[model samples]
Target: MKLVQFWRNGRPALGLQTERGVVDAAAEATRLGVTVPEDMAAAIALPAGELERLLTPLLQDPQCFTGAPLAPVVTGTDRIFCIGLNYRQHAKECGLPIPPAPVLFNKFSNALAAHGDCVKLIPDYKKYDYEAELVSVIGKPARNVSEEDALDYVFGYTCGNDLSTRDLQFARGGQWVLSKTFDGFAPVGPCLVPAGELDPNHLDISSTVNGEVRQSSNTSDMIFPLAQIIADLSHHFTLMPGDLIFTGTPQGVMHGYPADQKSWLKPGDWVEVTIQGIGTLRTTFC
Candidate 1:
């Protein structure tokens, strides 16, 4: 089943995507006198068995649903860990060598923006780029996890655009945090597919800007795949529920293009990233 969150009373509330429309799970639970998670964070933190039980009956009769405006998938996810240069071709495109281990970075909660939202670009800064990525949502606390069992801790998957400001990222002594953590820099969602429903390793992922394809590749191109990333990171620090992992982007970023062919994102440009099984995440720069 696909899950999402839509704004209710100016706050994020849990909802399920169905053929008809988005089912307000919290509202439906109230109508039926049943109890379930109240928000996206709680739903993702739920143990597998309990979450399944909670959804079983609701799937039978989805009433009082609406096509409400969406909120960021996890409004308050604890950590947003990001992988950098994890795709071999992407590394090559940037003229960097393959890394011996996973390269990690982070984005704070303030960067979270929802699908269909407008990302206001910082003025006088020109090199805004788009990165299409698959995000893994953590379901349970994990420490010292083995690669073989790493996926067991995953709750689901979502689409994300790791929007970057090239000048701040490269011109300021590698100011990755300052460059990428601008408010609304990370736009995610539209739908979050349960991990059991899709294979993360074999999916088609692509991104387009103003209807022109920029990045076109598959999850299969990731040099350090999801399981290895989790296992490696968990050994150093615990991975908690509501935490997110942004598996890196593929080649074709503007930074990778020849000098004459490169043009950064500008105001009024619409950016969209799509992953097979999961829905498209669309945002506009203003």
Candidate 2:
């Protein structure tokens, strides 16, 4: 089942993309007098098979969610972990060597933006870039998990755009956190596909700017695949339900272009990140 979060009144509400249409889970659950998760975080924490049991009935009378806008697929996540240079071709384009391990970084909740939301470009930064990536959403607590069992902890996958400002990223001897984590920097969604529905390590991921394709590659190109990344990260810290792991981007970023050919994103641009089976996440810049 494809899951989503959308705005209802002033708060975020749970939604499900079903065969009938987008079902406002919260509303349907209320109408049917059924207790269901209120949002994505709550839904992720539901015991194994619980979500299906609770939501399956609601799907029968799908009340197509319309008019109201979509929110980020996840909003209450505790951590947003990001991997850098995990793609071999992307690393080669940046002139960096393949890393011995996954390069990890993080973004805060404030950076989360929904599909179709307009992201304001920081005027001080001249090199805004787009990174289309696959995001893994954790379903349960995980620590010291082995690569063999890493995927078991994942709940689902979503499309993400790791928006970056190159100048701020490379300035001051590398302020990765500052370069990343800006408000609305991490726009992910459209819908979250349950892990069992798709293979996490073998998806087509790509990015486009104002309708022009910029990056095109598959998750198979990732140097540190999802399993290894989860296992490696779990060894260091506990992965909680709703925690997001941005698996990294493929080749064809503005920073990878030769000096004269570089074209940074500007105001009034539309950027999109698409992952196979997971749908597209579109962001507008202003």
Candidate 3:
């Protein structure tokens, strides 16, 4: 179920990674002459169980499967809701107290890009940094949901890089929006794994800059875990399919280190965010 929206000959198309270098789901169906909607968003947005049926043919194809070509997971996501300092260890490293609830923040849709897309380093800020995080993809519209039922609305999980401009994130006089939500700042998706695949509470998340590991922690350290976050966030707005929730990063960020030792991200640096069950999300600043 590694769904992706790809461009073939300048046209937007949906594809799924198979053994044969990303079988063009829609096109393959057209060839077999079976017309089925294959757009990644449309398939996910379809009523509950319908998306699976659309992929049944491709799953059973005799060619056996391969992987996909380079393509962004989705062209657009409704919202990129992010949380700040939700990890206890991370909070301690930053010299901040753990909050009673999820410390929420947000990244705009413009920040959405594929795993390997280059993150554009704007001239506005000098301290570019990386925050490796686990991203949740909402499967259904949910509001005022109970913690027990919170995860039911989730379609899958993925890796995300919450790229930031530290100067604007903290040193700015205004909101965090200036520091977060910059274009190409949030790099998401190598694959979107179904919720049933992993225990959201105990999964491990880690990040590496170039070849050096910088951040390593498990979701177990999260002060506000998935259910609580879903409940809290849904209290204010309806969570819809394709919407993203960026769970906060763990400690070891450059900002957590002393000012003199902070080695912020620079152009030509490669970042890889990896979650235990979900695959790695790789990006470069250029």
Q: Work out the TM-score per prediction.
A: 0.97, 0.96, 0.91
What TM-score does structure 1 among the candidates reach? 0.97
Cα distance off (Å), candidate 2, residue 105: 0.8
Query: After superposition on all CA atoms, how large is the RMSD of candidate 1?
Result: 1.2
Indicate the residue-level lDDT of 97 in model 1: 96
lDDT, model 3, position 66: 31
- Give the least accurate 10-residue stretch of model 2, judged by summed lDDT: 59-68
What are the per-model C-alpha RMSD values against the true structure?
Answer: 1.2, 1.4, 2.3
Candidate 3 per-residue lDDT, tens place, 1-286, comes to 6665666665446766654556677767776667666565776677766666767677666342334445556555658899998899999999998787887777888888786788889776789889999888888899999999998888878888888888887774755877888888888878677666778899989999998999999999999989999999999889988888999999989889987898889889999989997778899889
RMSD of 2: 1.4
lDDT of 2 at 5: 89
User: How far out, in Å, is residue 21 in model 3?
Assistant: 3.4
| Window of ten residues with lowest summed lDDT in model 3 | 62-71
Error of 2 at 214 (Å): 0.8
